[model samples]
Target: MKLREALALAIGGDLAHLAEVARQLSSLGVRVEPGGDVVWGPTRLLGKGNNGVVVFCRSRHGDIYACKIRRGDAQRPHLLDEARYLQIANGVGVGPRLYAYTRDVLVMEYVEGTPVADWWRAAGAEERARFVADLLRQARALDLAGISHGELSRPGKHVLVARGGRAVILDFESARPGAQNVTQAANLLRALGLTPPLEALRRYAERRDDLAFNELLSSLLGQLKR
Candidate 1:
């Protein structure tokens, strides 16, 4: 089925609202990539979550993007609101680069990467140290930006580790005003059995400065180095 055919099922809106969704896509000059994989969730979707259904779409200039369409029953069914939060995350170089957004749809950079857990398991000690350091750096960035990821404590599927070992955090639906990202990310580090005490990493959050975080990072790196 094509995007429109799939939309009626994905978005539980009435006929007019559905028509508007189609209109919006066309007016914005997006070319939907009809063919999709059936993995990651039900149907031929790229992925699905509480707030939206993600699909691949290309621009007129041939730039591919991930499109998130809001669900009718979504608790926070405002794609634009999510876009705003995502933009804040992007301000600090955190989330996928947001391109354009309407109330029902958000177009963003398509990250071609493997999930962090899958990548982390196969990486060596050096690679693991590199990833841990970068993740902590990003968590520190998010903390300074004041955007709490809300779900990083168990971020198994929330992080994508791409080629060249760059780790990109995904899914900002649970983000809010207060940020505890460093603390939460430390939770992930603990889960990975990275040998850092949460209490120590927790201090980095309190410092809110590069010197303190880097000192902690140096300590972690010292242990990671063999």
Candidate 2:
């Protein structure tokens, strides 16, 4: 089936409000083409989530972008959150670029990459350790900026493993300010069942000269043991 047809089927044919979504995208200058279709030229669907679909599209000017559309009530909030997070994470190197957003959709620079889950399963121990370190850096940056990715524990939703040792985060629908970075990291590690370098992770967060975060991780991991 065609992509549009497939999208319609995925979203449910009889669902209301989709027409409004399409119209909103047009008003936001998304270049709606003939046949009620948005021309994201040379784009493909990367993945679909429970409430939304993610597509990679090339703009008419030859720029690649990712478009995410959320369904029903999740549309507006997620769109706003993604836009804000992209703004915050722009120079942090842990997120995508925010281009445009409507009530139910978001457009950003496309990240060509793999999910961390698959990458972690296939990577060597060294690469895995590096990935963990990078993830910790990202968490620290978010913490410093006072942002928390609320759904970081959701399997494929948390981290996107890109080419060239680059990692990007996705799904900020629940991101909020004032979250505890250490607790978030612990939760993520526990959910993934991986023993992170907690001492190093803590030192990175605290910016200490000779602090031992591994001991902290050990302590935390031990707590989980009891």
Q: Against the true structure, whose TM-score is highest?
A: 1
Quantify all predictions' global Cα lDDT against the true fold.
Answer: 0.77, 0.61
What lDDT tens digits, residue by residue, belong to model 2 across residues 75-159?
Answer: 3444676667767866566577787787577777777677776776677655655666666567667766778777776555567
True-vs-predicted CA distance for residue 138, candidate 2, Å: 0.6
Error of 1 at 8 (Å): 2.6
Give the number of colliding residue pairs in candidate 1.
Answer: 0
* Model 1's TM-score against the true structure: 0.89
Top lDDT model: 1
Stretch of 10 with least lDDT, candidate 1: 34-43
lDDT of 1 by residue, 67-163 (tens): 8877767777477767888898899888789988888888888988777777878888888888888888888888888888888877456887878
lDDT of 1 at 118: 77
